[model samples]
Target: MKGRNSIQFRIITGLLLILLLSVGVSIYLTTANQKSNLLDASQRTLAVNNEMLNTTIRNIMLSGEAPIANRTMEDFRKITGFLEFELYRTDGSTAFNDYDTLNFVNDYQSMVMFDQTPRVEGRSIDTEDFQQVLMNKTPVISLNEDTREMEYYFPILNFAECRVCHGDDEFIRGVSHFRISLDSIYDQVRRAGVLMAVYFVSVGVILFTWILLLMHRTIIKPVLDIGETVNIAATGNLDIQVDLDRNDEVGELAGRVNHMISGLRERRDLELQNKVIETRLEENRKYLDHIKEGLLLLNSERRITGQYSVFLTKLFMREDIAGLSLADFIYPDAERFADERRDLDGFLEMLFTNKTADMDMIMSINPLNEAVLQLDQDNEIIIRADFLRIVENGEMENVMVIFENLTDIVHSRHELEEERQRRESELEQIATVLKMGPKVFEGFIEEGERAFGSLRGNLTNFSDKEFISEAFRSVHSVKGTARYLDFPGVEEHCHQLENLFAEVRDGSRKVDKSLEETVAGTLDSLDDELVLIRKLIDRFKEFSVGSESTQVSPFNVFGERINDMVKDISNELDKDVVFNLETDLESVPGLPEIQPSIFHLIRNALDHGLEDIYERLAAGKPSESQLSLRFIHEDNWLKIEVEDDGRGLDMPALEKKGVEMGLLKPGVHLPSQIVNVLFRPGFSSRDEATSISGRGVGLDAVKEDIKKMGGRINIRTSRGKGTTFVLLVPWKGDEEGVLV
Candidate 1:
């Protein structure tokens, strides 16, 4: 903190100042060291030279003691400059002088042995250190005062050369003394300081410039380029790119940034396109589902080929329909109905050949009833397929599949055929009944003859009442028939007989024996004719009751129609259904036609035939209950089933429950017979329902009313298993299918 004497600042400041000060001091110290060394060296040289010269000069000046030696002294002096040499005798004199200032007095005293002074002109010394040599030999060293210039003391020492001259006084004689001026050497040391200053300033400037230039080239340029690219990117200009002209860390960073921007742009555009495509696809799907006809698409292998909505899914029932093997999802019988193998092969061939294609395919499907598998009765399944092939994205591809339901049209044809057959049969029966009517008249004539004969012959055990009773019965029959037909002759005959019987009861005697016989005979004759008429009438009534029914209840008409369906059909192919009739289960109070629907269902079961006995037996079922017609009252519904042990309906074949299929209306659950394809226009399960299915109009009509009544129909079977028809019909019908 403090300096002891001359320094003027605090230690911290002072030390820095001192360091600055030391810079020059270092230079001064170096100069001083050189100067001191030179001075000491030069002083020693001068002393030695001066001591020899002092003696030599003394000998030469003492006047020719030896000529040759005197000459040598002059030569030595010339070489030495004779600058500080002096000789002072014991008497005090300048023995030889090369200069006017040569000292023989106090000057010598000023030149100490190692100390040289310019003012000490010629000082000499004789000391105890050189005493012996000084006393015996030539002057080794002399001590004298330099009075001319200054008082100087000289100190001397012995030298070997001087000791040679004074053997006994070697110490003193060998000593020599001289003083040499050292001022000139000081000038050389000062000159060196100037050269060091030049090197320090010049080299420092050059080195500093070189280092800074290197820093700019290596570090600053890369930084500026990074800043420019960042600014461009901030403006959302992803196209701006940086080309760092090097394979270095910075170059890799630039590449990463460019890659990130490219990806973002690509993904954004892709997302937008995907959104639009998805929206349109959803709309198109809805439009397809809205159509009346069911539509489906299948791949080359007959598997469902694409994604569809839940509504579209109704076209096929199972979830695994799409992308599965055709056999896995479709009912087993469906494989045959659709002719799947042929269709699949054709489709694949068309695709591979790259040709446009279209075809109409007929498939057998039990669109309505599921229970009976008679193609003639409820199990008839027929479908029309329309197909097309097209190219997509430059690749041969299958186009859309559109399905149209043709069942109703086919069913209409069946009904027409049934009606024709029914009309013909009725006409035949009418002809037979009419012919029998005449036969009654001929029989009456013969009976009259017999009656008269009976009167003459005497009869026994006869009650008069019995005769009247017999007569009354015969007369009553004729009268009733005559009244019914409005027959004039027959009614008159009936009146006469009644009158005769009345008189007899009153006991009239005018009715004589011959007269009584004739009257009795006439009555008897009429009775015989009436008997014949009755026989004919009996046959006619039998025919009429079963035909052209006046009561068209849904069940009766449906039953009749179905009976026609199984005409000539077999017991093996179509066994009768033992109906589970629910007697207490009444139709809604207002709908009297429900019974007809129930009856038709049983008929449908029979026509379709129980599945084959073999199939039924294998399935652990009775081949006959065979057709099981059940009607159970449910919650507001009459859940009925008209099932058979026959094969199940092939749904894919009869895809559309059409008019030919006996569909009364849309969304209706018809009777089992109408629901089955067995009732198709020309379809007849003659082979299958050997006993029941012959006429084709079985289920086609029944299903119509059932559906209108708000019911559902389902068919189930394994190919070898029996078929079952399940109906869920409202207890109260919609009347749409009901007859007036």
Candidate 2:
């Protein structure tokens, strides 16, 4: 109903109003004309009747037949449809009245003799018609609405015959007045008005019905169909169309609606195509993200703009890098790249500015190529960045930056190089040992021992600058001798020691307690290597045909070997280490089998337990750090202790490394538990591999070796002070007799 009240109702209502107004106008005009014609016809008929009556009266008076004229007028009045007919004298007296039977039309004495009724008496005689008839002596006509009649007054003019009776005294004789009822004409007009009203109403009804049907067919029905089709299309049904077949505005509207739906359907198909393309693009993005290499797209402004692989986020450690300047993302702090020549900013600027430049040349000089980014204090990664220029429409549009993480590759290369160097050193040492016969090898070993022993004696009298100078000279001499002997391993160790002392003597490095301890550790390592070389030579000596009678004392050899190994460690670490040989080696038995264990313990102490010279001093210890090896004969156990005045075990650092290696859970542990971490296979406190302790095999091997020797090692440590390792070997034989 509400929908119907809109255009359809308004159009029908407007048409009805217009039709009604037209009908009302037509009825008003027709009725007005009909009334005018009817009134005019009545007036003309009254005038003609008055004229005929006047002429008849004149003829009758001329023929001398007044009684006959009077009778005729009486009969005419009776026969005519007039309400009243009368004659009045000029003095306002009636000449003849219809109500009086004795009155005569032209009787001169009858007006006074008879009982006369005035024609105009008790009537409105002051009217214009009566005034004109009486004063001007002319006929006057007027209507009387109360009686529904037309009144006419005619002046009776004096003529020749009228003067013979009246003596010719006046020009006007009397007035004749007639009142004619217009009721029949009024009835006809009323009936005609009613019929016209009915006719107009009928025409309005028929026109209204015809208009309603035509509008429904031409407008309302088409609009409804279009509305329904629009509703369907709104529901995502673009196939709906209004099939209006007409050459009208509605047809044009239907055509437009069909075109709109066709456009909608095409748009929907395009949307589906876009959806599929977006899905494929997303999948491709995922694939790119998972690839090993990182990718970045930079616009012409050298800003990261378009899509980038997710790996780039991981590589750069940032997520919201799009729309950011490429140089800014790579190097956020400009001050860090202050060196203009080697600055990454210059490289990027050059590459971005010079479109036609060779990318290979730019890449060759690219500082970011194989750049090392320190992720944190303990973590770093090497990355190789490559830039490729993307050209579009003969212009450089973008640059694709590729980042490849080279940390593992670089580390692997280092490890391989180290391994190769180790193998070459070993083979060279073996070759040199073979080339130099037993006598020459023995001479070299004895000379090395004497030189190291002298250096150790001099280090005991530790001074600052003079002592460092002497140390450098002594290590340099030993290094030169080892080089001459082609003992590359010993030579390299001596060279490192030489470098340490040289740095100290030249003031490049401080000769603090830590430095002294470090030197001591390095010296100990070098001596250990020498001893191993000596042992190797001795093995070679055993193969000699004439070497069977060489009876060397085990006690002296063991003591000397221990001293050499400790001194080597002290020098190797660049420390001023004072080694005390407290054990009387002559009292020990089975020295040969226990030598390896002793060596392992001393090496472990040097590498893991001992502190550098600076650390010893910082701990309020001597600048010449102390390391002691002692042997004691208990009731049934042979005990050896190795202790150092150096930094104790870092239990926290050990625990952290353990957690990282997945060897131990994260928590506080007992000192013994922390110490046991040292012996866990493949667990080390060091974050990186080097020539020393990170292998994780040393302490574990030592523990196994000690266990095989029927000994267990115990560790004691004090924070900021030092550490001690005590080995207890069970002995069953008599101590005195077991000595060799």
Candidate 3:
């Protein structure tokens, strides 16, 4: 029963309930209305009959024809099928009775004496309607439940004619009572109710049957089919499709179920594929672990994932590296490598987002390649990293990072290179000594000794600009010759001495006792190396009378030496400098004798006058700074001009430095006075001393040497533009003939 209480059952039950209620209410109303209408009709009929009977009795009594009135009353009862009819007097005596009329009035003697004889005693009427009719002299009708009949009463009144038979004082003479049986009317009403009940029952049965069939087809059957399909689906039978070809809610539900099953089927296949991939990945991971090289797998986020090789843990010096961001381990200091981190982030972003594009170019310049890892404060390692993109399902998923430690390899290579260079240098030094014949070697040795002797003499008397200038010139001349002879050890020592003079000349280092000692020590070292070279030359003296020497112009040799010095300085400072010799070598006078002074000026210009490449670029100049040497003869004087497109002298800075050095007061100095400060013995503009400058000796030396040659040195400069140094010396004959 509970199972049967479904939508269909509920619908049917409700319909039946409504049908029954409607039919019952309708039947009740019908039966009630029928009874009321029948009662009304019965009362109206009795009223009319009573009125006619009263008129008849009144006329008959007036005419003294008692027998006719009695016979009429009798006929009314028999024709109308009334149960009883009686006329009673006011005193409750029955004046006329239909039963008596039938019994006596039918005979002639009873009819003739009906009005004259004593009134037959009426039944004493004590009913309320009967008493009302008598007292009020009006007609009354009522139903008798016990008899199943309706009784009617009419009060008789005394009129002028009725007074003849009765008394004139009486308002109502008598009462007429009539009773009618209700069996026939009740029978009609019962038949009508039965017919209506039959009609309603028939209609309800037909409607219920039609509705049951409609509900089954439209709602119940479809629901049952959906339920059964769902049950099958619940049991994992995804192949069972709900094929309800409807455009209703049920149809939509079926369509959703079908879609769900399709998704499930796809998911099952994908799960199986995932398992296969996982197995393959595990196998690959195991293989990778055995390899000696460090290997790590990183996701697109640069986070470490999956199993990593044991070597990787050893390389990074961390064991619990899995599931952490690779950036955290590699670039541990965010503040230190913030820019690199951003770059790496962008690199990974491109690798992940632009999966289909080739990443070879990006990987080639990757910062991690051949990066130096500072494992700790004391221990550092060089590593080469290689990246391989990992793609899955046609999309980039992860990156495989392979790290190779190159620290040992690099160190060994460096040591090997140093050893090879040492051996090569030694052999070249021996070969240079052998290549020169005894005469040329002797001349080279004699010139080197003269240059050293002059430099040592100047250093001993290094109190004034002339002595410093002579010392610088001697050292520079020796350095040039050694370089020309391919004597690297001798040349290197001379170069170091030249740098010391350069620093003193640039006012970047002070010429104190310590400076003198350093210069003396360097000169001693050079002397030792020179002696060793002379000994080597003597050892190889018998091997060859040197080949005929090619004659080169003295100016050409001087220019070449200057060129080499500038090149060397340029290389040391990592700057690009172009040196131009804009002079007629034939016209230059006293070239060999004044070579030291010219060389000093050239070295000074290279070390101080030219700006570094980066500074030149920032100043909107060419990356390679320019230096030009112009030699001209005018008015019996050889004017040598050394000009450079460099950051010119800062006069104010020089003045401030002069003030700080107690060379000048804190007041403005004339431009000439500021220029003269360059000739001040230890006045330097540079703050820190370098091997090249900040020793305050080069320009002072130049000035003194030019003065000794009976000439003058002057400088002209413009801020941020360039500087020019002009040496005006007396023109002498170029007695050393040009060999070119």
Predicted structure with the largest TM-score when compared to the true one: 3
Candidate no. 3 TM-score: 0.43
The candidate, 1 or 2, that scores higher on lDDT is: 2
lDDT of 2 at 219: 88
Per-candidate TM vs. native? Answer: 0.22, 0.33, 0.43
Tens-digit per-residue lDDT, 395-415, candidate 3? 777898888999899888888
lDDT by residue (tens digit), candidate 1, 582-689: 324333332333444444455455544455456567777775554445556677776767666566555433434344344334454444544455433334334222
| Poorly placed runs, candidate 2 (over 4 Å) | 1-6, 11-25, 96-124, 134-138, 160-171, 263-740
**Global CA lDDT computed for model 2:** 0.71
Whole-model lDDT values for every prediction? 0.47, 0.71, 0.73
Model 3 off-target regions past 4 Å? 1-289, 316-319, 331-342, 412-556, 564-600, 603-653, 656-664, 676-740
What is the TM-score (0 to 1) of candidate 2? Answer: 0.33
Which lDDT tens digits does candidate 2 get at residues 299-394?
A: 877688747888788876788788987657766655774563347667778887887778788888888778777655686888888888888798
Q: Point out the worst 10-residue segment of candidate 2 by lDDT.
A: 115-124
